[model samples]
Target: MGDKANCNCHTGNAVYGLGLIGAAIYFISQATSFIMGVLGFVKALFWPAFLVYEAFSYFAV
Candidate 1:
């Protein structure tokens, strides 16, 4: 029973991460590549940069 909860936590985290990536790709598509979907998806592979920027910007203030 305890193990099941732990497993679900990890699974949920993985799903959340994937969802963020998908969202980033969608936003990029809307901004730059609505015509060529793959370009935005390729760009979204660097989603970590946005996350890092947000973290630094938040703390810098």
Candidate 2:
């Protein structure tokens, strides 16, 4: 007998990927320079953190 653990993480990954793409597009579109575009891509990678921080801030009041 084999014990297999079932995991369902693909949906979360898909959502995160979509959010990253959307954030990258919005950030890059507003950037005026190549460096800012690069920064935007970096920022997109941390979008979840920013979202959490903003949510906490909004609710902290």
Candidate 3:
């Protein structure tokens, strides 16, 4: 099985890790920009929502 078939576990982990990295990048970008006024406001309003999303993604995987 190791030699003949490709394992999907590693790929899934890599994708989940990449998703977290991308989320961090997006959050940082949103935080650093002053022009994204509405987005910033919305983010502030839903910070807990983001946290919940992250928690579920991390734990439910």
Measured by TM-score, the strongest candidate is 2
Candidate 3, residues 1-61, lDDT tens digits: the string is 6856864557866765676566655665767566575566556555657888999999995
Higher-scoring candidate on lDDT, 2 or 3: 2
Candidate 1: Cα lDDT at 6:
65
Q: For model 3, which pairs clash?
A: none
Residue-wise C-alpha lDDT for candidate 2, range 22-53, written one tens digit per residue:
99999999999999999999999999999999
Candidate lDDT scores, in order, read: 0.70, 0.93, 0.65
Candidate 1: worst-modelled 10 consecutive residues by lDDT: 32-41
Q: What global local distance difference test value does model 2 have?
A: 0.93
lDDT at position 20, candidate 2: 97
Q: Can you write out model 1's per-residue Cα lDDT over 16-49, one digit (the tens) per residue? A: 5896688666867587546456666655666677
Arranged by TM-score, best first: 2, 1, 3
29 in model 1: Cα distance from truth in Å?
4.5
Q: Model 1 residue 44 lDDT?
A: 69
